[model samples]
Target: MPTERRIGPARERDRLADAREDERAHAVIRNVRAARMVAGRADSAEECSLLLEMLGLEPAAERR
Candidate 1:
């Protein structure tokens, strides 16, 4: 009976973690789509690169 009780909460934690992961994945997809739209509207190569960096779609250069 005691072992059964512990198992229930463990299962619940796993389920909650899965739900949170799903939510995070969806958010990343939305951000990528928005970044792509902004990139499309960008006027020049430099402007598009800056916009993508701002949206975190591209990694910024390291400062010396």
Candidate 2:
């Protein structure tokens, strides 16, 4: 059998990072919310390219 690797984001869209009762759990949850907020703000591929450039990443190659 050949080993395989995932090429994109994980299938589990949401997950908890800590025990439900842990005080730090709120911070973890907040980080997820912040990520979603940024993802929601990008309305187009061009916007995503700009965001990546701001983060100092090269724009991904165009897909066929």
Candidate 3:
């Protein structure tokens, strides 16, 4: 039977780093939205907070 090689520790770490970067990108968007609210240009801080929550993230919590 043909088998595939499993990822080693380094590759696993790289994958995790990539996932973290993706999450940070999302956080940046939320941060921008929250900033807009602070700047008096938007009225959807609640909506932005909800988006973050739906992404398995919570505003004001440390990123995992």
Most accurate candidate by lDDT = 1
Clashing residue pairs, candidate 2?
Answer: none
RMSD of each: 6.0, 16.3, 8.0
Candidate 3 on 1-64: residue-level lDDT in tens? 7598989999999999999999999988987676445435425777666665655545564549
Q: Which sections of candidate 1 miss by over 4 Å?
A: 1-7, 59-64
TM-score of every prediction relative to native: 0.63, 0.34, 0.52
Ranking by lDDT: 1, 3, 2
Give the winner by lDDT: 1 or 3. Answer: 1
- Clashing pairs for model 3 are none
Measured by TM-score, how close is model 3 to the native structure?
Answer: 0.52
Candidate 2 has a TM-score of 0.34
